[model samples]
Target: MDERKYNMAEEVKVFSTWSSPFALRVIWALKLKGVEFDTIHEDLSSKSPLLLQYNPIHKMVPVLVHNGKVICESLVILEYIDETWKQSPLLPEDPHQKANARFWAKFGDDKVSSIWSDVLMKEGKEQEEGVSASMENLKYLEEEIRGKKFFGGETIGLADIALGWLAYHLVIFEETLGLKLIDQEKFPSLAAWEQEFANAPIIRENWPDRDKLANLFGVLREANLGKGTPK
Candidate 1:
């Protein structure tokens, strides 16, 4: 591990929502860095003043408040945590390897929203187009994972952490959207990656219950589809 940027702080505080994939990213990063922090669960429906104050721009959850300084954006917070507490280390030691990891991390961050929007937004021609684009992105990722157990190599690292949200949360999106985007036969690498991602002790233990998340997704889909009173 490289020298830490921030030391001497006894504890850190994180503001987040349990069901959010963005929040899960922060949780995974902190856990990987072996950082002990207090978690403040926020209600998205009723945003707290502190949450708004911490993230004035987006007012979103998954804000990291470390030593009284607030940091918004999940990916940015992950990098901050990595730089501040370099114990286990999220990024690689080599500069080139770190660049490679950051590249995939950026790709996942940039394209995942479109994938979710396409999967959860519409049907017919629009959905078909979305699925096609989503598959293309997934294909690139599958090739990236061709020979490695995880994105960072033999172990999970920044790229895996960035992409981790999709591993568990995507099932809800797929079921709700009725899209077969990641068929096991078609994308066996990512299929296997998802199982490994979900099985990580920190990930498995920290995630929102699958049934609960599925119910939430069902509600969102029904609301979007204008039927069933959002189940």
Candidate 2:
């Protein structure tokens, strides 16, 4: 919390927010690698001067400041973490495998907008179409993850950390809106991965408070739908 403390001992510090899955990615990676870092919580509503200085362009959370060098973007931070800490690699050694991990991570991010615009913020035929599109995208993942417990075999890897947002976000979105984004029976592998991901010790510990997120998104959904923020 104190600026002076940052310069005192630890070389790693993360600018973060409580509910952001992006921020959590950084936290998970650091913990997985057994890196010690201090987290400075940011209030997005009132942008901090320190955060702005560290990440001048995006001015966002999950900014990794190591030895006075700043790294912006969550995905970039994950890569940085992997490279800096040799223990518990988030990516594989094989080039082809690494490429595959990057691909799936991008695939997951590209789908996020659709969830917000097409599914979460729509209704009637539009919402139905959104759900269908999501399921179709998920089907690809279903097949890919069929035999493995995680995206990169048994251990959590780049793709897992990158797309980890979905584990909690989709569940909260589904519960708050009463819309089924995923049918566990239809997407058994993906469903299993989601459950396994959320329950994993590191993930479970770093997760945003479930009830808090549920309430926040529930109100957000209502506000977005012209439901006037349920009293």
Candidate 3:
């Protein structure tokens, strides 16, 4: 908390939604930095005026407002938070290591968006193919883990926070879609990482109500499959 940047009069706020992995990333980063902020939950069905004003182009949840300046995009916000608050640094001090962390962070996000999202909406042969590809994508992360406590070496950092969605979304996908996203028997390290990351105190405390989120995903799954209501 740099005194110049941490003004007592300034207010920090995040335009968020209940089930947004992106929004939650911003929240987790803030908590990690020990920054006090308020979350204004948004109904995506009806986009709020402020949210639109803050993020005119994307009009998405996770529009972070600090003082009067607005920040959009989760990954960008994570970098911003890291720069603003120096304590418990998110990226490494070594330039080469920091660059590597950024690379993997983007890789994880790309895989999650491309592989997992496609698999979520697929079924039958297509779904099988998607799941197989997803597994292959995760193997890169498995190799990256390489017996380390986290991607950040010791504690959670940029790559860990960026990929934290797997800790929850994979679980949700497995439960709702009945697809095997992570197999502990094969990818022991990734499985262990997910369990530890999901249950970590800060992450766990901010988790959305699973019952509600699971029901939501179940409904989405049914819709994607062109089926009747979920059981």
Best by lDDT: 3
Ranking by TM-score: 3, 1, 2
Predicted structure 3, TM vs. truth: 0.93
Superposed on all Cα atoms, model 1 deviates from the true structure by an RMSD in Å of: 2.9
Which is better, 2 or 3, measured by lDDT? 3
Q: What is the TM-score of each candidate against the true structure?
A: 0.91, 0.91, 0.93
Candidate 3 per-residue lDDT over residues 7-108, each given as its tens digit: 455688999999999899999998987788888999998898899899999999898898889999999999998998788799999999999999999998
Can you rank all candidates by lDDT, best first?
3, 2, 1
Per-residue C-alpha lDDT of model 1 across residues 103-200, encoded as one tens digit per residue: 99999989856876676766778878888888889999999998778898878888898898778788766776666777799989988888888898
User: lDDT (0-100) at residue 6 of candidate 3?
Assistant: 70
- Per-model lDDT: 0.82, 0.84, 0.85
State how far residue 109 of model 1 sits from its true place (Å): 1.6
Give the Å error, residue 164, model 3: 0.5
What is the clash count for each candidate, in the order shown? 0, 0, 0
